[model samples]
Target: MKDISRNDLLTKIQEVEFACLDLNLYLDTHPKDQKALMDFNMLAEEACRLRKIYEMKYGPLTNFGFSLAKYPFNWINDPWPWEYQ
Candidate 1:
């Protein structure tokens, strides 16, 4: 994929987050909805993959640092949510 603008990536991330949240809310009342559960899982996986890509190119937006392998020192470079464009 071409390098996405920070703002675009942030927007996409927010959209995915909202989708996940909405799905969770529905699942709370419809726990036995197998189709919904499968769809939610797929969305969750996509969101995770997008997040990892964004973090790798920019910096961490969550508590978990982008480069877990580089640990300790790398954590210091993690970006706060507000840092995103």
Candidate 2:
């Protein structure tokens, strides 16, 4: 995949996460939904992979993520999710 901007990648991760949560909610009410369950698992995996990529390239997406900062406190230098344009 071509390199995407940090904001775009973040948006993609957020979208996938949302989809996973929504599918999970649907599965809760319809426990026999095989298609929904498959979709949920796929989205969940995608969200996790994207989150790892984002965190590695940038900084921690959450408080408990891995930090690969090469300089002094890059975590503080990076913008909050909402602060992105």
Please report the candidate that would top TM-score against the real structure: 2
- In angstroms, give how far residue 65 of model 2 lies from its true place: 6.0
TM-score for candidate 2: 0.80
lDDT of each: 0.77, 0.79
Q: Any idea what lDDT model 2 has?
A: 0.79
Write one digit per residue (lDDT tens) for candidate 1, span 1-85.
4578877888888898899999999999999999999989999998998788877776666554343433444445635556644
**lDDT digits (tens) for residues 1-85 of candidate 2:** 3389988998898899889889889999999999999889888888888987887787777654444455565667647756777
TM-score for every candidate vs. truth?
0.78, 0.80
Per-prediction tally of clashes: 0, 0
> Which sections of candidate 1 miss by over 4 Å?
64-79
Ten contiguous residues minimizing lDDT sum, candidate 1: 64-73
Instruction: Tell me the lDDT of model 2 at 50.
Output: 90
For residue 17, what is the lDDT in candidate 1?
82
